[model samples]
Target: MLSRNVYPQTRPGKWSVLLLLAVFSLLIVFALIVQSGQPFNLDTLFDNGWAAVVSILAIAAAFGAFIVGLYTIFRNHERSAAVFFTVSIGGLVALFVLMQLFL
Candidate 1:
């Protein structure tokens, strides 16, 4: 017998899922752009290891945001948490696009 709480909670609202999917799709596009070999040098911090540093920092920031968002959601602040997560992810997607565009 599965308790009510044992099952995963119902998925978020349709708009929420749609918004997330859109953001994720944009991320994929940005990744493809980066992988397409467009010549643009945006890394000025580390001439030799800029790529590695950028990748690490980006991943760390995303992980941190996800942890905070998950905490907020589990603390009964789903609305705010969703907003935070969405905004964070959206910002990352925009950054990726800009990087690919200019760099």
Candidate 2:
């Protein structure tokens, strides 16, 4: 009989679920904007101020990191992507707090 056992399958942890929820919420907001007939253009973004611009980028980076993390988990057989995704999401949240506090 063959002796070696391989192919272990692990369920994604809370980080994946949390990141997906955040991404979904962001998409919903965008959909609302579209439905309201509000143009989400660069001019509107610039009108919001530097804090808003930076916060938007932080959010986008967090979302992109999450997606990359999921892809890495499935394709590259490495877990380091989770670290990046977690860090980015944390930074996004911290930026939000900072904006609420100071801006």
Candidate 3:
């Protein structure tokens, strides 16, 4: 079996690994939704003006989560997982930006 050195092989690894996975998945999903904001009708976006504000804040939160996740992974000495999170988060961030700028 290909061992995933992505997470620590310690007693705390099980729960921490699951938590990290959840964070990464949430970020990816949020990024995809933001990238494909087509489903979010801009026309109705301001229907509750604050809804749009909340959505913007949600994007900021995802960015915050990405940074926090990176710090957490490295602090746990999960070097491989740190690299994986970096690439995953960075790529999605880039995709989100491109989609916003070009589409």
TM-score of 1: 0.35
Which run of 10 residues does model 2 get worst, by summed lDDT?
A: 4-13
Clashing pairs in 2: none
Model 2, 6-30: lDDT tens per residue?
3223334344545545655665665
Best by TM-score: 3
Sort order, lDDT high to low = 3, 2, 1
Tell me each candidate's RMSD, in Å, in order.
Answer: 10.5, 10.0, 6.9
Off by over 4 Å in 2: 1-48, 81-103
Which structure is stronger by TM-score: 1 or 2? 2
After superposition, the stretches of candidate 1 with alpha carbons farther than 4 Å from their true spots are 1-48, 81-103
What would you estimate as the lDDT of candidate 1? 0.49
Task: Estimate, for each residue in 34-101, the C-alpha lDDT of model 3 and write its tens digit.
Answer: 56645555666555455556555545544554555555456755545544554366447647967998
Score every model by TM-score.
0.35, 0.36, 0.40
Error of 1 at 22 (Å): 19
Q: Which clashing pairs does model 1 show?
A: 40-103
What is the Cα root-mean-square deviation between model 3 and the actual structure? Answer: 6.9
